[model samples]
Target chain A: MKQRFLNDTNLLLVFSAAILLMPIWLSPLGAAYPDLLQKFAIYGIFAIGFNILFGLTGYLSFGHAAFLGVGSYAAVWSFKLFTMNVVPAVFFGVIFAGLLAFLIGYISLRRSGIYFSILTLAFAQMSYNLAYSVLTPITNGETGLQLTINDPRWIDSMYITVEEGLPSTNLFGLKMSGYPGFYFCAILLIVCFFISLRIFRSPFGLMLRGIKSNQNRMNYTGLNTKPYMLSAFVISGMFAGLAGSLLAVTDPLAGAERMQWTASGEVVLMTILGGVGTLIGPMLGAGLIKYFENIFSSFNKNLLHEVFSFLPDGVEDVVVQVVSLFVGGGWHLTLGLLFMIVVIFLPGGIVEGFQKFGGVFGYGKNKNSDSSPQNQAAE
Target chain B: MDSILIQILNGLDKGAAYALIALGLTLVFGTLGIVNFAHGAIFMLGAFCAVTFRKLLTLSVKVKDESVTMFAAYKDEPYLKIWFGDTGEAIIDYAVPLSILIAIPFMVLVGYAMERGLIRHFYKRAHADQILVTFGLAIVVQELIKASFGANPIPQAAPDIVAGSANVGLWFGLGESLVYPWWRLIYLCFSGVMIFAVFSFLQFTTYGMVVRAGMRDRETVGLLGINIQRRFTIVFAIAAVVAGTAGVMYTPILPPDYHMGMDFLVLSFVVVVVGGMGSLGGAVTAGFLLGIVQSFASMNEVKSIIPGIDQIIIYLVAVVILLTLPRGLMGRAGVMDD
Candidate 1:
């Protein structure tokens, strides 16, 4: 028990140190990259929340983006109504997403496996269609909702501001854009991560794993698992909502495409790519995917050619063209190949690969000691 | 009244395509127990095959006119055209029908290879992994098609006999205004015949009985010394042929595009789910029902009340049906465990 406690403390310390050190490392490279870090942190939060339901309960939702989109639209509406303050916007978003999840999960969780996936997908597509048409006033249809300069700011009047139009509402007058937004999202992600850690360790979490492995056994044990699954769904929805709200804060826009089935599939990919059941795996997955999306896509043929100038002319051209295929317009193809490889070879995802590597180096034995509880209990 | 008839005719044609695709999905899912998300991509590839055939038929070399430029003044270049006289040209002209012959064998090989190569391994894996891998494969196939074919929708014209609208109203005592496209009528009939052939095959053949038995219990069938996996692979091939043929027939209605598969993938999955997981009859019935409902919802009357009801009506029906009857319309009880 003492050794286990020491191992747990070391793991926590390493995680905290990594989180703290990430920004320090990234900032030196490019401090003022517009909303890049914010995007990563927010999406990480979404994936983490998704992992709670999918990772624990073994319910694969192909429509979690519906909640995320709902939260975003709700936040945008909150900004339209009460105040430009981020608190009210985010709060409303989370609440609305949770409510929506409650209704959907109530119906959807009745079916498991592929049926559940299809049900979620159907509901999500319905949401998308509605947002595209009937709910156009809220979602702003295909054109999307944008924050104009003329938006009212009730919170700004309380603060001392010399500017006439609504001053950008901030946390204690600190601008909630750029670096501040990234920090704000990072802090929220940390809180979400800690909460997820607690949930994973909690008895409820154990029941969820039980439900995942053997629902029949749990039912025979006289424990009603529906409410537990529903609660996890709601909580995950709220987390997605939180992510959506953060997205709105950074960009102040909401599009119907945010809730499309493709977007839902993306979170699934992120979770699977990272390590479905692992806490930090989703974060790593989200970071890796988002980084590839934002950074790799920006590298054009000219940049490729410049980088390959040292090679022979024929070889240089072939290399540039081939490399560009994975980076630019062929990103989906690359993602597909990666997904296939990961599913076939690394079924446990990047986290499992890391564990294996650690084992090879003799550092994984202690790690597995603490981790085996969750894995064994799940199985 | 004439418009209504025309709309109904249109709806029937669309329903035919849906029925075929859904039927294929149901067969694979029922027999093999694989969700087969790449089925729609297979459909898209079928359409591309038709486009490719059409392109191949029209391939010609262009020769510069010597009289037009100083550079070409000295020589007249011979241009080669691979024309095999009038009959062969006529055969090439009827590319849509020819595509049926090409798509069957091509898609069968694709199905066989896919099952043998990738999906066979995923039988024991989690459904999530199966879905992800297949979904990824779909994306890869779609992107490859896009790279090869470009993004624009390619129009594949029907042959001369079925190129234009036919006034079938004269025979039915309706006004001449109640016309349907000739190709669409042929497609509907062809699909009906195909479905009939499939039904007859399954009803009569010993192989079909073996397939049904394997679907019921592979272990039991294997105990009896039957190679159930081979039958399942054949079923997969049949499913591919069904979807491919559906795509071939549908090309005249909608131009073929790389993204067509993604568009149909969701709706087809909805159809499969609404029909129930492993029921063939359920798939056909639900496909037609949803198709008709979708068509009616898109009408001006329905649109006045709900602007995009048509777009979401199928999903609405699916959710309601799923909630009220968790086993779907024809799903076996307890098959879909929470």
Candidate 2:
């Protein structure tokens, strides 16, 4: 037991060190900016939580962004009613999102497979449309849920009164922005990672995996899978809620677009890209995608031209035209192409690709190579 | 009473588009057993094919006009008008309608290429993998469309003769205020003809019989020495063509946009599930049912009572039906029941 605990500790230490040093590591790639780093941590938490249900249980949800959106709304509302203190806001966010998830998961889990996915999607779309239109009084419509000067912050009135401009989210006096915010998110991500690791090693996680492999067999063995799957779903939802709240804590605005199906799809893409079901993969996937979006979208025709300036003029122009299609407004094209290629070639995603490359160089034993790609996924 | 009648008319028009799209989705699911997230992308592609045809028909040549200014001034006229005179003008005017003639073959080829190239390899993969790959393909297709034609909605008009509203309520003795768009009526008729053709082809043809057998049990059909795989490919192509034609006609009602396919994809997917996984009749029946339910929910009386029921009614209906009827309205036993 001590040895097992030590192994977990070692894994957590490595992950923590990597995250703690992200500013240093990512500086070379020009992604060490505080806001983007905060996003990396926030989305990292979301993807990890998503993996709890999708990676383990094999149930594909298409409405998780609804929970994220709900969390953001709750947190923002907390700010409006209470104070700029993030603790209570995050608390409310988690509670609200979890409650929503419980209701949605309970009803949605009644059906399995594609039916379950579509049901969740329907629910999310309903929420999205409501937020964008009729629920404008609560959600603020397309303008997004934001704080105003007239907000009755009861806690702030009781405690320290802000006599200046708009108050920023904070932990007492420490502002929730810049390096402090990134560290705050990073610490939370590490904690979330540790919890996920413990879950992965727990009997509950094993049962979820069992359900994923064969639900009918589990049933025949007299195991009730409903509560297990439902718990997984709720736990994952709480994780998403936490991430969403963190987004509010860092930036302090929540938009209806957060609940869009595309946002949900983004997390799935992140999970799949990094390696679904792996302890470290979701975070890595999240970081990679966020990094890609930032880097790819920033590239302009001038940059492309500069990169290809070494070539002949005509060739450079041609190269710029082709490469330009994969950047800027065409970044989605690049993202889509990458997704297709990964799904086709690297079913286990970047992790499997790394493992395969290592095996080729005779550097490591590729134990997963014996298993088929589908089964190897998320393992 | 008149409002109710008008809502029904609106419902049928909406139902036509939903049924058309869902029918194609069912064909793919029934025959290929793959939940194609990119199926909507094919529908989008179909709409774009019409857009492409329209662009081609109205391709212009510039003639320098010295009368306007000292500097060269160019006046543009569609080459089609120059080539075929008034007949070309007429064709350009009816571009959306005439597009069908070109779109059918083009859409089929696109569908065939999609299946043969990307989807064929995924036949035995997990549903998750299929969903992921097809979704990626969908994003790719839509992005390409956006690259070629900017992201704004491109408005396509119906022929001038059918552009105005007709007195739909007059036949029912309701007030003339309850009018319906003529193009929408044509769209409904178009949907009816397509649905009947698909059903008939499956019901009465030897090729479709073998394909039906293949859907029931691919291994068993293969054991009987039929190239069921080839026929299934054809079914996929036909499904694409159906979705494409629906998209072509729908361009007039809802302007063609890159994201339009995705919006319809989600709703049509719900329609497919509410109909049942593999049941063709269930798909069509549920399509109209949900469409009417949605249209009625959007009525002022309904909205005043329920508040935002219109936005969510279709999904709410889907959830209620799935919870209660599990297999959906016309679901065949054991089709994705688990």
Candidate 3:
């Protein structure tokens, strides 16, 4: 009981500290920086949601982006029809994504392994093509949907007067254009994190673990596992939808590219790299990858030349050339190498690495021992 | 009618590529139970091989004509400059055809190395791990190719003898309407012969029987004292050769690009899945069928009704077939149900 209390207090303290530090760290980077952070946070949330379905259930979905794309489209439509209020748009996005997941997951979960992967992939590709062509009016085709100056800001106009012909969205009079958007996304992420935490600790989570370990045994015990799996699938889809809604809220744009299988694969990579099934790992993975993509891609040879200016002319040229190979335009090479090394050496991901560190520090050894039996029983 | 014929021809060519790649994927999966996501990268490498060969072939020794007399200058015969250069120069002109021969062994070796080095380690791991590791390897291979070849598509022209189209309509008395490129025809015939050879090798030979047995039950074959893993490695090499050959032949049609592998990867996997996981015949058949359907769907007439149907046709077919026949068209019974 005392240990449980300690855990709860530690969690609360961590939460409070994170909330306080976000603004402090973000402030120095200025307003535009938070937009990117918001994107990272949103994608992190999506990856975390995906990890729940994939990491726990062992279902490698190659179509999760379909839900995200659908959610974004739904949010954009909501913004178009209903008030420019973010809440209703987000809510509708989650519902629409969940509904779509329910339909697809029902058909897809029937098959397992590579077939399941192929099925999800096929579905996503179908969606992508459909959006690119058949659903062009809805998805806006390749040009993508963008908020125009003519969009009816029903609630925003009534709540506060903005200059005519200006493009903007407001959430209960709070502008979603900058810092407010980041805070909004961060709050959503914290909420999602806590909900995922609850679900992970719940009995349902234990049963899902059982289903993953041995589905036949679970069935033989007379437990109806389909509903449970479906529930998990829907919940995960909703989380992805939330992330999608946040993306649209920040950017007010939706593109069919969001539903591409590569985007889905990116989330999978993030989950695996950060440590699948670990709560904070996917978030860390998303942040790290996005940071590298945003920051590393911006660096050019001129910057490299400046950094290596102290070196001799010939040496500096060689150094700059070599550094450019690994840095500018060759970011994917570095990412691929990182992925290969991580998968080969640390298959359990960064979470496992952290756990090993904790073990070395003598903090997790006894904790793991006590948890092993419970884990085994749950499995 | 003319448009229909053209679409059919286009589809057949595209289907030829899909069939070749899907055949390789099915071969590896059937023999080794490994879903190789890197098959497309191998295909791309094959195209690069052709490109490299083209580059190597174009190397020449240029000499200046020094004769000043009107008749003598006009009749100047350019002699090959020799600094041990004639021998190297002669080899360059025949590089493209020679690359096909060279690519086979090179790709086979790559296949063998890849199997022995990375993939062999993951034989005991989960399918997810296998997919992840292979996918990672695919990305690495693709990026490496990009680093070497740059991002743009490199055109690889066929030999002058087979560069232009053959007028089949002349023989048919159709006013020279049915003109097909000679190189494309050669590719089709080559792919056909190669497919036949692969089928014949697997069907008629004792080694093929052993491979079939191993595919059926690896442990049973291992217990029978046959080294199944080594055979699997060979099968992987054979699959690589097939994909590389397809890539070599396809370079003229689609030009070689680093990202070409990624573009085909999803479609090829769709073909493999639709063909049934371990069924080789199914893969070939599905490849052609989807290829034809995709071709027909891309027609202007079809596009009027169903916009971008060509892009989604294969995937739609895959989804429908998977839903209807969960085991795929010719998947072994009780294999995919789980």
Candidate 4:
């Protein structure tokens, strides 16, 4: 018990130190900028929550983006009706997404395997199409939901008055944007990580692992699997919701595109790329994909030229042309190729690759203490 | 009543596309047990095949005009027209139909390559891995198309002879106004023939008999010393060809775009599930049923009552069917639902 507690403490300490000092580590990778950093933190939370349901229970959802979009819409609505404070907005975001997840989860969990995936996908696409057209009144159609200056923010109007246009979201008086916003997201991410860790060690999480491994044996042992699966689904949905709320809190806008199936595919890619079921793997995956999205996609021909200026004139032109294909408008091609390679060659993802490399080099843990939970989850 | 008739006509045209794609999907699923998310990408490639054929037929040569400034002011005379006079013009006019000749061979080769190179390796992997890999392939295919053709939708019109609306209302004693596109009717007829041909091929052919036996129990068929694996490969290629032809025929109705495959993929999957996984007949039936339901829901009266019914009717039907029937309308009891 003492050794286990020490291990947990060590893990938490290391994780906290890494996240808190992200500015130091991320700067070298050119992702320490505020917007990208916030994205990393937000998508990390989304992936972590997704991992709980997918990695643990092996229930692959193709509609989790619905909850994320719902959360944003709810948050934006809260900001419109109530105070500009993020607390109420985030609260409503989580609650609304939780309710939506409950409804979708109840109907969808009736089937498993590809059937479940299809059901979730249908629900998500239905939500997306509705949001695009029929629910235009609530979602603002394709224009998206945004805060207006003339609206009756009942509590904000009564308590505080600002003369310089629409007010930004705040915790107390500190603004939720730029460096401060990133730190706020980072702090929340740490809390989320700790909670996920606790769940990983808990009996409830063990039952989820059991369901993933062999639900038949679990059923034969007299365990009701539906409630457990539903709970995980709702919890994960709430995580997506919270991330959505954070996005609105930072930017104060919610678009219908946020709930698109492609967005859902992206999170799946992130979790798979980072190594599913491992506590830190999803966060790593989120950061890597976000880094690619923000940094790699922005590399224009001019930027490429500037970077490769040291090369000979002829070689530089040739290099730039080839490198340009993997970035900018061709970024999706690169991403698709990378994704295919990873799924085919590294099914367990980067974490598995690292472990194997370490083992081959005799740098692995001597006592097999590094027999990661991900390995068990992958089985 | 005329409006209702027109709506039903519209539904059948849309349903034809759905049925063709779903039938192809079910064939592969039944024989190979692979949930091919990339199947829609095959359809997209088919549509592009027609576009390519048109482009090739209309390849223009710049002729200098002495009235202006050399090549700066030139006349674009198509090489085909210059080479063969009216014959070249006629070929360009009939490019969409003629493209079927190109699509079949190209699609067959693609299907064979996919099965032999990538899909055959994934037969023993988990369903999640299969889905991911195939989805990845779908993305790569679409991205390549986007790189080559650009992101905009390329509109292709039917030949001038069949371009106008056919006044079906006159036949029904409802005046001359209730008309439908003639090409859509052609599409519906084409899909019907294709589905019938596929069904007949499977029912009468000895190769198809071995395939059915393999679908029933692969190990038992293998025990009898038949090369079931090779036949399954051929079936995959056949499925690809069917999807490709369906796409080629659909180009006149809906413009070809890089993302069209993804749009149809989700809807087609819903059709497959509602029809019952692995049941070809169920797929065809459900495709038409959902298509009609969608058309009906989009009517003003239905929209006023149900609001977003058109947007969700297919998925709603799928959910209801899956919940109530579990195995779908004609799905085998233990194929995918455990």
Candidate 5:
């Protein structure tokens, strides 16, 4: 039993078990509800995908949310035109997002560093602005796309008769909502994790790491790095597409807000706040952020007073007043501060923090080495 | 013909604001080799400085009205109005301009502290890290402003003298319909003067020469024992003041909000990129060029040909420029090109 537990495969099993049993463990953390759980799983996939591009290639695309938005729109369109089955929606989502990423990456990859970031940002902003106004026929404008009861679902209707109300997305008649919806997302998350792990260990992944470390060296060796980088970009965008389809699968609405620059910033924050390049860190960061966004934003003076009730009356009032600022509507301030602190001190993020704590008592080798580009020039 | 002139006039004021903000952004990028995302927040703070000045001038004292007796009724009278009567009213009317007095020194301190305290450490760090830290600082500053200002757009009126419109068409013997706001004209002239002052200062001054030399090669400048760090702090402060004054002057046009800085920050970055990164002339030229193009895109005639061209024109132009030029309009080779 001890030998099996210490095996390399044991880590994947532990991760899967923890995710599957989120209801039991996260219940204590006040985030066991289906809506929040779905978000955690979906954002986990999004952040993990983002990590593949940003962590491995060191090319920070500030416009990644555009891919997420495209995936969602494509998934919803599949449902609108074809069937309520999730298989086609997810497929369309990934394919469309990958295509969009290919186009953006083709142009943006022409310039690296800050110029690349600006190019991506400009492209995403164009898509978003177009969606909000000119593309209202497709995006349904600011009101967002919704399903009506009488609408034709071409493929689903061929197999079955029309239902009374708007049909919910299903996978082989298994409803994709509530707890079941979360399970579907969780399973996909696990699959994604395995895929990401495989990529991390692959030779392609080594080439990506080399490209990040010193692209000049890789180029001088007569290797073409553009195709490799473009492939990474497409794959990550497809993952984002998967996450977006999951978002629409559970809730059938796609808005332009999904493609906003701020949304792009949030994913970057999630990956960075977790631990860049570490497989599990991005997922953990996504969950942590989503959990706080839900739980912390809900906290008010009354909730604080109850939590601090054990203290004396005077101290309780003081504590509640002070604590309330960091919660509720002021939560973003804390997030911003946490991001600053992470980037400034713990560049390796929470995983490194844990590794260091473990290192204090003499742990094993630290596999999550610092991925941040070292500042080479000195004043 | 008159409509074209009016559109050009409309673009000038907005273009001035963009140029001012972009100028500051490019200056910091060139001098400090830092991508200061918080520059937008500095602009917002400058607007709030006007708001704060107005708020201070309008501080009220509640006076009980003995005539109204159903319940107790009190009329809130501005303390300024009560303290000095007509002169105080006149002072309140000019609050927007007067705030520049406070914004300058306050922003200098803010820029100085930001540079010495937080930014200096990250100088040797990666550019990505610099972007992250500065972005974080921007968020924090925006949130702090929101906390103080109550997250609402605060409207500030221009001084009464320049509040109304001037008949520009009559000056050119066109039509009465081509009138424009006096404040906007003043803003254009002010921006032109400010831009000229900045350019001439850099062109003539020994201090400016050192800073320009530092931008090209920092190590050589430092070897001369010129205390380059102190001048860099001043440069940062000047950038802050430039953004601040632009913000202060701009409040009459667009209401000041905590989020305005962020909105402008992205566009200013676009302008900086479109102009060519770290190139001041490029930033200024791109700022006005995009602004004019944006105004032209919004014209009814243009919209008839291409629907919603106004909304995406800037980004579309950026894409085309980036694809064609690669170095931006005025970018030097090897300046963040890779």
Candidate 6:
């Protein structure tokens, strides 16, 4: 018990340290900026929450982005109507998303496998289409929901007067932007991760895992699986809501595009790429994908030229031309190829790849320890 | 009533495209048991085949114009026109239909390559893995198309002879106000022909009989010493050709874009699910049904009543159907429910 406790603490300490020191360590990778850092933290939370439902219970909801979108819209509405303070915004985000998720989860959880995926997808698409068009009065349509200087923030108006420009979303006057915003997101991520880790080690998590493995057997054994599955779905949806609210808190804008099917696909890829069911894998996957998106997409022909300058001019030109096709506007191409390779060669994702490589060097004892998540969960 | 009639007519062409694509999707699901998210990419590739054929046929020579000596500008005089005059022009005019000749052979090769190289390897993998890999392939195919053709939609004109709208309303005594596009009617007929050909081929041939048996139970058929794998490859190829032809025919209606396949992918999957996962007839029926429902939902009367019913009617229908039926319209009891 003592050894296990130490290992658990060690893992938490290592993870916290890595995230807290991201700005310092990630400078070499040119991804230390506040916006990208915030995205990493936010998407990490999204992926972690997604992993809880998908990795833990094996229910893949393709419409999780709907919860995220609902959260953002709710947050922005809160900011517009109630206050610039993020607390109320977050509450609204979580509550609205939870409500939407409960409704979708109630209907969608009726079926499993691809049926579940399609139902969730349909609900999300309906939400997206509604948000994009008919719900324009609430969502602000294609222009998106934005805060304005002239608008009344009821709570803020009661407390204090505002200036000419729109007030930034804040946590009791601590501005939720730049490094401060990233740290706030990082702190929340750590808390969420801790919650996720505890869930993974809990009896409830084991029950969920059982549902994932063989729900029919569990049902035949007289266990009601629906409530457990619904709980998992709602919890994950709330996490998505939290992430969505955090996005609005940082940027103070909510757009319909945030709930697109492609956005849902992105989270799914992140979870799969990081290692499903494993605690830290999804976060790493989120960071890698975000890094590629922000950094790689910015790679222009000129940047490629500078990177390939070491080679002869003729070779450099050819190399840049070839490489340029997979960067800048073509970064998605690289992502697609990388994802295919991972699914084909590394189904268990980067974590499994690392374990395999470590195993090659005779790290058998370490491999046997805590690598089989099922064993740990079972215990 | 006239509007309703026109709407049905309008739905038929789009319905034809949906049915054709869904038919292809169901064939793979039934025979090979692959989800094949990249099936729509094959459709897009077919549209591009037409685009490429036109581009190839219309290869232009630079004719110097003495009118612009400041830069000595040259005008592109199509090589076909330069070589054969009216005959070349006529050939270029017919590029969209003529591309079918190339689309069939090319799509077959692509099918064979995909099955032999990538898909067969995934025969034993989980459904999730299959979905992910195929989705990845879909993305790659779209990206490659974007890289080559640029992201903009390429317009493929139907043969000029059939470019105008037909007097279908007059034929039906509905008046001169209800004209439909000749190209669309042609597309409807073309899809009908394609669907018939596929059905006849599958319904009659000994090869298709073996395929049917394999679909029912692959191991049992294999026990009988039939080369089911080879037959499955041919079926995949047939799917590719059907989707390709559907795309080729759709060019005049909806301009061919790199992401066109992706837009269809979701809808086709919905069609497949609603029809029944592995039911070919169910797929065809659901495709047309959903297409018609979508068209009807888009009417101003319906929009005013429900406000954006058109955007979600198909999904709403799918959800209702899946929830109520569990196995879809013609889905077997144990097919993919788990």
**Segments of candidate 1 deviating more than 4 angstroms:** A1-13, A26-34, A150-169, A366-379, B63-92, B333-338
Candidate 5 per-residue C-alpha lDDT over B27-47 given as tens digits, one digit per residue, 9 for 90 to 100: 999888899888999999999
Q: List the residue pairs that clash in candidate 3.
A: none
Docking class of 1: medium
* Candidate 3 Cα misplacement greater than 4 A, ranges: A1-9, A12-16, A23-32, A153-162, A308-316, A366-379, B1-5, B60-95, B168-176, B334-337
Candidates ranked by TM-score, best first? 6, 2, 5, 4, 1, 3
TM-score of each: 0.92, 0.96, 0.90, 0.95, 0.96, 0.97
Docking class of 6: medium
lDDT of 4 by residue, B1-338 (tens): 87998899888878888898999999999998888989999999999999998999889999777788655788888999999999988888888989999999999999999999999988877878888889899999998898789999999989888999888888878988789889998999999999998998888999888898999999999999998999999999999999999999999999999999988988898899899999999999999998898899899999999898888888888888888998889998778866
lDDT of each: 0.81, 0.89, 0.80, 0.88, 0.88, 0.89
lDDT by residue (B1-338, candidate 2, tens digit) is: 77887788789888888898899898898898888989888888889888999999899999777688865588788999989999989999999999999889988999899999999999778788888999999999999999889999999989988999889878778777888889999998999999999999999999878888898899999998998999999999999999999999999999999999998888899999999888999899988888888899999999999888998899999999999998888888877777
lDDT of 4 by residue, A1-379 (tens): 2344337778888988888788888898887889998999999999999999888888889999999999999999988998888889889999999999999999998888878888998899899999999999999999999998876789888889755788889877789999888888888889888989888889999999888878888989998899999999999999999999999999999999999999999999998888777788789889988888888889899999999999999999999998887888888888888888988887877777776787899853522233233333222
Please tell me which model should have the higher DockQ, number 2 or number 6: 2
Clashing pairs in 2: A276-A378
| A1-379: candidate 5 lDDT, tens digit per residue | 2343434477778889999999999998889999999999999999999989888888888899999999999989989989999999999999999999999999888877787788899989988998999999999999987777766788988998887778899998999999999999999999998888888879999998888888888999999999999999999999999999899999988999999999898898898888888888899899989988999899988889999999999999999987877889878888888889998998777888888898999977676574543721110
Residue-level error in angstroms, candidate 1, position B176: 1.9
Q: How many clashes (backbone atoms < 3 Å, residues ≥3 apart in a chain or on different chains) does model 3 have?
A: 0
Give stretches of model 5 more than 4 Å off.
A1-8, A310-318, A370-379, B64-73
lDDT of 2 by residue, A1-379 (tens): 2344336788899899999999999899899999899999999999999989888888889999999999999999999889999999889888998999999999999888877888889888888989998999989999999988888899897888677778899988899999999999999999999999988889999998888777889989998989998999999999999999999999899999999999999999998898877777789889989988998999999999989999999999999998988999899999999999998998887877887887888864553332235642221
DockQ score of each predicted structure, in the order shown: 0.52, 0.60, 0.44, 0.53, 0.58, 0.57
Superposition error at B277 for model 6 (Å):
0.5
TM-score of chain B of each: 0.92, 0.96, 0.90, 0.96, 0.95, 0.96
Output the worst ten-in-a-row residue range by lDDT, candidate 4 chain B.
B63-72
CA RMSD of all predictions: 3.4, 2.4, 4.3, 2.6, 2.5, 2.5
Clashing pairs in 6: none
Please provide, for model 3 over B1-338, each residue's C-alpha lDDT reduced to its tens digit, 9 standing for 90 to 100: 66677677778788889989999989998888787888999999898888887665554435444656453444322233244456655555455666888799889999999999988877666677777778888888988888888999988767667889988668667676788888777887887887888888899999999999998888999999999889989999999999998998888788889988888888998988888888999888888889899999998899989777877888888989988888788888754456
- lDDT for model 1 comes to 0.81
- lDDT: worst 10-residue window of model 3 chain A: A370-379
